[model samples]
Target: MRRDLASNIADVPAIAPAVQSAAADGAAIDTKGFSSLAFLVNTGAIVGSGDFGVKLQESDSSGSGFTDVAADQVDTTAPATLTATSSYKLGYRGNKRFVRLALAKTGGTSIALGAIAVLGHPDHAPVA
Candidate 1:
């Protein structure tokens, strides 16, 4: 197997153990030292019927504010019956110093989600 290096530009203290149950903005993640972000989602439990969405967001003032990046949103394929082994991935290009994942759950009885955000560092420094 091929090996690759990973970086956490968001600087989160730890990976989010549980995803938001309702529609809400998540904690800000610092992306100062990286150029890209990858969001990995693992659903451990899901019940009832409802759709779920995860979107990429950005902030310019650290964690004080954030705005959704509509083009980078990801949605669950099976809203009615989410499988425990289901996984999803979203990618974002480096644009701001801070970034985050926004969660939106609708009409679901119960669901448990785990997410880990990873940042990718450029192989070479920017030339200007």
Candidate 2:
């Protein structure tokens, strides 16, 4: 059922602090009860010789085990490269209990970037 936008304001789901990419790859995120998620990524500090890639990942287990979710990612034509400051959005709806963003960088020491994910549960009913 479609809900009125105003009524859902208080229940709006959001990820805590925006996720920032580190110098190296990080671990998976836990999404036990959320049925949906939207990730927003902002990139910066890219040099001509640096490259970066971000992919949406999911896993049934809550641990480090994770695999890429087919077809759900940013940069459709070419893998994400930090040629300039840019913003990208990606969404996921799956049966897995855990989800996360995977970051990969090459030819550079770092790529300045941050991401935030908003999660939703269809069964979440708002209080009157």
Candidate 3:
């Protein structure tokens, strides 16, 4: 049997919890030593009605050119109706070296949320 322990993974902040009323880009996670990544989203308050989606972007450079990852590449799609005080996630399996998550919003008040990037399957063990 095999198991993936904490030592095998690296956790990075994708975004911090805030009252977000506008579109924002999350942290650009570098996947040099790791081979896999996942974005975990925590949402709070539903003051806004249609802030239910986040786009996964990737690029060769960490600073720019982060366009949305293809729909088929992501493991999960954020629900159409986002619930208050709930959690969501999206997995990354593309070949890009850098990746990030961008919150998508339209004509709304504010939604409190944040995210974290979990990187796993390191090229070498112990993910230091």
CA lDDT of each prediction against the hidden true structure:
0.60, 0.57, 0.85
Measured against the true structure, the TM-scores of the candidates, in listed sequence, are: 0.70, 0.66, 0.91
Q: Write the per-residue lDDT of candidate 2 for residues 41-75, one digit (tens) a residue.
A: 66667654566777777788867668878784432
Q: Residue 75, candidate 1: how far off, in angstroms?
A: 12
What digit string (tens of lDDT, one per residue) describes model 1 on residues 1-128? 11334322333421365644666665676766666667776676666654566677877876576877656343333333345658776676647777777767666765677677766664443311
lDDT winner among the candidates?
Answer: 3
Error of 2 at 21 (Å): 8.4
Q: Which portions of model 1 show Cα errors greater than 4 Å?
A: 1-15, 72-84, 122-128
Candidate 3 lDDT, tens digit per residue, 15-102? Answer: 9988788888999999999989999999998684746568899999998888999988899757865567988889998999999998
Q: How far is candidate 3 from the true structure (C-alpha RMSD, Å)?
A: 2.0
